[model samples]
Target: MAEKLGTKLNFVQKDLIKKSTKEPGRVFTVKEVANSYGISENTARA
Candidate 1:
């Protein structure tokens, strides 16, 4: 059987990291993060 790649955080995580700063901390919920990056909530958690 072929091996499957593990799920990974999407663009939202990248954007969140970029948007987050020492001041704001860029903390966000899975849903919010998913919506921000146009990905599914489950994918966001991954």
Candidate 2:
């Protein structure tokens, strides 16, 4: 579905997943992700 629409995980999303995998027990909030990526909090939540 997303692929058909040409939608995919962005760099920030990929990096967040990689970091989480590399460090167990790590947690990230939508606000933190948004700040780190310079995106809006709502966008991070989505």
Candidate 3:
């Protein structure tokens, strides 16, 4: 989705997104990832 939207994601964002997909334990939203990682929502979305 980021590729289609042309958003450049950093390593951390990429890792977060990857884990979110593969975990299958709990779903992560932008807000959840941000809170978990202590990052801003914009960074999570990136």
* Candidate 3 vs. true structure, TM-score: 0.48
Query: Total clashes, candidate 1?
Result: 0
> What are the clashing pairs of model 1?
none
User: What are the models' TM-scores?
Assistant: 0.54, 0.73, 0.48
Candidate 3 lDDT at 7 equals 58
When 2 and 3 are scored with TM-score, the better candidate is 2
Which pairs clash inside model 2? none
What TM-score quantifies how close candidate 1 is to the native fold? 0.54
Off by over 4 Å in 1: 1-10
What is the lDDT for 5 in model 3?
A: 29
Please give the CA lDDT of all the candidate structures. 0.68, 0.82, 0.74
Instruction: State the local distance difference test value for candidate 3.
Output: 0.74
- Rank by lDDT, descending? 2, 3, 1
| Alpha-carbon lDDT of model 2 | 0.82
Worst 10 residues of 3 by lDDT: 1-10
**Alpha-carbon deviation at 8 in model 1, angstroms:** 10
What is the number of backbone collisions in each predicted candidate, taken in the order shown?
0, 0, 0
RMSD of 2: 3.4
lDDT of 2 by residue, 1-46 (tens): 2364224767777788789999999989988888989999999898
**How far in Å is the alpha carbon of 45 misplaced in model 2?**
0.3
